[model samples]
Target: MAASACATGLRGSLVSSFHGTWGTSMMGEDYPALIQSVPRYVRVGPPVRSPPCMKNVNEGKGIFAPAVVVTRNIIGKKRFNQLRGKAIALHSQVITEFCKAIGADGKQRQGLIRLAKKNGERLGFLA
Candidate 1:
């Protein structure tokens, strides 16, 4: 049900009571054998529902190796001699700065955000 139309008052109390009674038995065994028990109904919330924030998320977080992104960058002009330094000239820095510029570091992605904000300024759709 939509948040505004959620069952309230009697319906909520009724549901709470119904579920409360099902979790126990006079013989001390869990009443519902499984979540799909005949009398127990499973209700999935609306598709747009947000789950509780979970931990250990990998994407959108910089909790990954720097090597994968920085190793490909060229440090200097070189056709014969390759002068490379991991700390001083690893390609990861370019990617890191680029990400920082766009605010992927999460403090603020203002550069791209500003560009996007002004996208319509020069367009025929300018407001």
Candidate 2:
């Protein structure tokens, strides 16, 4: 399904350039007169039609639901010291940024709101 969609987009774009050029050149005088003309529909290639299942869905803004996890492995048991200072510091930086945004007001807060909205319902902040 994904492959078909990609091929459709790429093929349409490739042929569209020729289609536009053909239309413009066809309007000019002193074009080759004896050229055997094929039907426009036949010569221009078949139209690209998406699968019926995707007709009502907007491909660009589709929603995704995250799966719930029931079990998680202990981080340090298998790989000792693998996730020590570096992991902690990375998490701390993320927490600090969240705290700053939470504490901010007006202009600063708007940036956070915009990010949340851009993420759509993924963050569960907006329905």
Q: What are the runs in model 2 whose C-alpha is more than 4 Å off?
A: 1-102, 121-127
* TM-score (all chains, Cα) for each model: 0.17, 0.20
**Clash total of candidate 2:** 0
Q: With candidate 2 superimposed using the best TM-score fit, by how many Å does residue 1's alpha carbon deviate from the native?
A: 99
Which tens-of-lDDT digit does each residue in 29-108 have in candidate 1?
Answer: 54445534655454567666678874323322342223322433334324112433343244445645787676586444
Compose the digit string of candidate 2's lDDT tens values, residues 14-112: 874454466667765435552445454554667888777622222223343221111113334235234434554565566557758678545655565
Candidate 1 weakest ten by summed lDDT? 118-127
The residue-level lDDT of candidate 1 at 73 comes to 36
51, model 2: CA deviation in Å?
A: 28
Give the C-alpha lDDT of model 2: 0.48
Q: lDDT per prediction?
A: 0.42, 0.48
